[model samples]
Target chain A: MTRYTQPTTFYTKEHEWVTVHNDLATVGITHYAENQLGDIVFVELPDVGAEFATGDDMAVVESVKAASDVYAPIAGKVVEVNAVLADKPETVNESPREKGWFCVLEIKDGAEIASLMDEEAYKAFCEGL
Target chain B: MSDPTTENLKRTPLYDVHVEHGAKLVPFAGYEMPVQYPMGVKDEHLWTREQAGLFDVSHMGPCFLSLEDGIGGGDEAHAKIAALVETLVPSDIAGLKEGQARLTVLLNEDGGILDDLIITRPIGEAAQGSLYIVVNGAVKDADWALFERSFQGKAVLTRADDRILFALQGPKAVDVMSDFFPGCEELKFMHHMPFELSGTSCIVSRCGYTGEDGFEVLVKPEAGLPLVKEMLTDERVKPIGLGARDSLRLEAGLCLYGHDMDPTRDPVEADLAWVIQKVRRERADFPGAERILKARAEGPAEKRVGIRPLERAPAREGTMIEVDGQPVGIVTSGGFGPSVDHPVAMGYVRSDLAEPGTKIDLMVRGKARPAEVVSLPFVPHNYKR
Candidate 1:
């Protein structure tokens, strides 16, 4: 099992996780998304400062098997992209929540969290799979 | 998890084991194969390179061809069987040694490839005397048709669908097999050793698509579960999926049948002239031998070459390759090479521009990226001698 430094603070239906720090939410793939993707090769993150409505495509993550679009969990403006992924995309496999953070978004709509799955629900969903 | 393809596709013998181990099963080659298990493709690929990875390739077709006892006796029997097959392929079966296998291409008269296959002379112990063969899964029907129509009375082609095929590939494959079969260490590259794998008689060959020291095991389909279980008991071995298999083979510069060569691409253009033995080339018995040998001597209009994508962006299949702003060829197989830590691909370009180090451009998502035509095998092969 992969060790994550942060608990499941915030998770999207598409299986993205966000660790909240002040107004910035460091977004990365969930344990489920990483496991589903197999091995991540290239990550195409949105440009820094890009704005998106809830559910907009924020990034693209490609695994050896196929490519997937990372959707926004909540309405937000991209503050920073994970430039480190350009060199080490496999970090998402090793440190999914911490070092593999896709981007830091400045939260625009906090209510979007209410619609997202909580830790217990997400764990249950993963179990049901 | 909700794919209709998975519901309809056939499961391999390792299907339950894959599910038990949390493998993400996806449809591949008509079977529900694990794309990856708990460990991801990057980890699985690296582990296979360093250690070993178990692959369920049971979907691949295996068959045996036996020559019938003709009314005209011995030498006539050999002559008639060779003539029938030689008309469809580009190999001299008349010269194949007992128990020796030869990789050959089935070609159309216009010099196009039908499919690639490995044919082995499984004589004596296996049966009266038969030629064992394996071909790509996707084109097995077409290949079988070619055999059935051509070999009518001279030989009988029997498909071994009841058998299961497994590939244990990596630098540590020999070590893993040696732990089970003591004399497996003596099996040289491209050689086969018939052994009892967990009380089931099987054929273990020292050959694999991955450019690594590995073994391809053919066993009874019912024995697949127990065999895979026993093999995976070693910590060095992990179940790998088709995803990693593609990257590993691409890195090794091996061709994927339909992608790299098809009915329109001949062996010379595909750079597979090595499979055509000198005797076969001289005999001129195989189909399209006239066109193939002439192209071998004079070269073809295009040749397959490797491409190194300039950046992180991958060049997928069908991406156009250009040189100096003009279209030259198209990418046949392209992706991020997990083992090499960069994006690499293979495609056919004009013969003049196929040389290594030639700068080229790959049109990716409407943008052109700088690329170079490099010699195949972006990653070195680690085959045992």
Candidate 2:
């Protein structure tokens, strides 16, 4: 399994996680988000060449309970998606932060990443919920 | 995140037990019910199918309809009470054997379903003049009002809404129940009998919504928690919630009262004609009999059918269904089937498009997803006779 243990990861209010490395950023849902979804069965990913704005619905994660939209954490162009999720959607429930990353985006504006919540703030936000 | 809509939500008898088990509570049918436990919906669903899962259905209406004094006794009282109830529904209530249950639908004047319920004739001489009825939780108040207006002065309706109703469903359900209450194994499908569990008077019915061999126990409010705790002591049993219950019923092709069929949809159109027995059809004496019988003979315009989306994406309720670019119908209930390991749906469609293998399109997020009409009970039933 692909492992992602980056310390610079940022989180959105919508429960998406972003880990920026150089000019590209990897995006996925947080563990708390996947726990709320409950056993994802399908993942609809955007095309690799598609462009998205921050907060736009970039993908859909459907579970046995309900379907939820995964929003983009930063404005960028999609570079790659986790193709393995097509046959194995449970990866999100198993590992929402690592191998379950939805897609990687070529960063359009670096300053947008700085506006997201840090790990401490994200933990506090989840606790409040 | 505090919403005022949840302020008036009610709690079931097992509310504290659910919270202690780390359940995720959600508002359903005007009650704050647990949607799933820490095991999640899929895992809970699979556990019920493989072993046994206990569900707290206390929110549903469980009541008894008893005849007044001098209403006759023994078989005469049963016949009179059945005749009175037959006026509201299209089931063969009079023909039901003592200790037998039948699945029936309450009808409106226009022949649409008010609610689907399980009505049983109790055993023994003491409860002979009464019928035990269980209705959906969401419409219990409306159902009670209808009964009051329809059968006023004829029968006394006693509401046991505070009593807890738990359904233990799975292949191993009978085994577990037999272990708990000896002789429960003798109860056949659709049969119910009064029994005592740990010195508590309870009723155990050999029936459930899931297509599995199971039993539904109706117990006093105070005995609910202890009964659940005792059942969970067995390795085969676990506490299931509403999320898995929904998916399990969907997989079994059971129609949800409000979502699958309601006051606007009749039983014939819902493909539940078998519920209306042949003798009742000939008599044509119940409410909406004219419209229901006409639809039965000539067939309805649209019919409910099972759907399997070719893609992995789940098509949810209210999704539009089309055929050859023409709108046909809308999905009533759709979701992922944990047992089938695929997505399954049920909806009404033009009679011409209701046949199995007929291709259709499900409009999902502005795209038409390929799907096909298929036979129901996405997963086969395993009822023990």
Candidate 3:
């Protein structure tokens, strides 16, 4: 059984994954990204009501070694932020694709999903690294 | 000669072991050392705090120093060697007992810190009256030069660059090591003893940087990899790298030589006054001892303190720390502490703002974040005897 993603979800070159069921797409970091990041120490999420264009920097993930920005997969309005991450950032390392989900967005352009890499291509890209 | 920058980067004796364990290798101090392993920095940091972790510190220089002679070389050699070393550091080397170790700073004549080093007097009555020293990797060349020019032919300095040094640290370190070296469990902190491992004679020092019960083993470079593999075969031992080493030390409130300290920082300003012994401070011997003493009495203008950011953002090294509207100091070492589960940083600020609970601001990429000075280590340091 699949744990973190549905067959309909997609991933990005930066290793963020988004699961879309309708107008809303739930976003989180990929397992590969979390592993490379070492331990998730602190996570900065965008404001709940903030609007973003496709590929805009919306969040930040920091590890002991370095910090990286997590970009939005598609243009949308941030509906909810992951409040649990403030106290327990390691959740991203424990379950990067599930409980570690960063934010939910109201997808402004549903067609943007086609712009992202599919599951097969994403897995191959991660393996190449 | 080929361009020095393009020359091959050296590898420590245990470089292959790090690769076999899937460690991320990075260039450090002119050697390719492991930065982290497959378990990653966070797990390695916590596991080392909870259990035992093995570190390949062979890149650091371990050397022996003493007086030399051909015919008349008994008590006279010991006296000369002791006097020569006493000039370089402020430690009471003449009074140090056999097998005892002292942490001392190598100071410049201008009262700036050169580096911090560990000096062991020696062991056994039959051994020669030489001292063993382990110094930082980056400044080993400078340390060698200082000893050479100061002692000249009067004292002999033998470099042990071909040796391997491994640190086994954590609460269970002694238990794990005792399984191999039966007598190691009895060694106290800052103490060392000569022991045999796999039929090879080695020196195991009951000292470490992680604020945990641990031992640093010095062995022949050729035999280092096999020992590391053997130690790691046990479930309790894991391979740690530079990444975790830095984070663990930060969490323990230990100073990293170049990042947290430099020639510009004195022992007093860095809050390492305990290392400046009273003998040196009173007698005012050794380089820069006078300035250090004066700083201690009158107080250092700046002080190092811990900063905890109010937001989930991190204030990294080189970031500006400000008070009210003026810049005070810069963050020296900053990172996410795995044990504390938060971003923690250390830096120097004006003495008046060094008190805990004093509000401050950290400029992270031109954006100001709320911060405050708090007690160091962010997490409690648990050093077992």
Q: What fraction of the correct interface contacts does each predicted structure contain?
A: 0.62, 0.90, 0.86
Model 1 chain B scores worst on lDDT over the 10 consecutive residues at B70-79
- Which ten-residue region of model 2 chain B has the weakest summed lDDT? B67-76
| Model 2 C-alpha lDDT per residue in residues B240-342, reported as the tens digit of each score | 9999999999999999998899999999999999999999999998889999999889989999999999999999999999987889999999999999999
Tell me the tens digit of each residue's lDDT in model 3 across B220-264: 865666777889999999999999998888878888899788999
In candidate 2, how many Å is residue B190 off? 0.3
Off by over 4 Å in 3: A1-8, A18-26, A49-56, A72-79, A104-115, B1-7, B70-76, B125-129, B310-312, B365-370, B377-385
Error of 1 at B50 (Å): 2.4
| lDDT, candidate 1, B1-385, per-residue tens | 4776666788777678888888877777788888877777777888889999888888888887777662234444545566667778787776765556778888887879999998775444434345678998888888999888877876888887567788999988989888876787787777776787557888878888878899888889666677788888899899887878988999999999999999999999999988887888878777787888888989888999999987888888899998888999999999878778888899999999988999899997667899998987988888778
Supply the TM-score for candidate 2: 0.96
In the range A2-110, model 1's lDDT, one tens digit per residue, is 2234543767668888776556678889877886676678888888889988888778888776678888888899988888898888899878978898998897866
Candidate 3's C-alpha lDDT?
Answer: 0.85
lDDT of 2 at B15: 90
How high is the CA lDDT of each candidate model? 0.81, 0.91, 0.85
Tens-digit per-residue lDDT, A37-113, candidate 3: 87778888888899999878898898889879898889999999888898898899998888999999988887788
lDDT of 1 at B49: 91
Score chain A of model 2 by TM-score against the reference chain A: 0.93
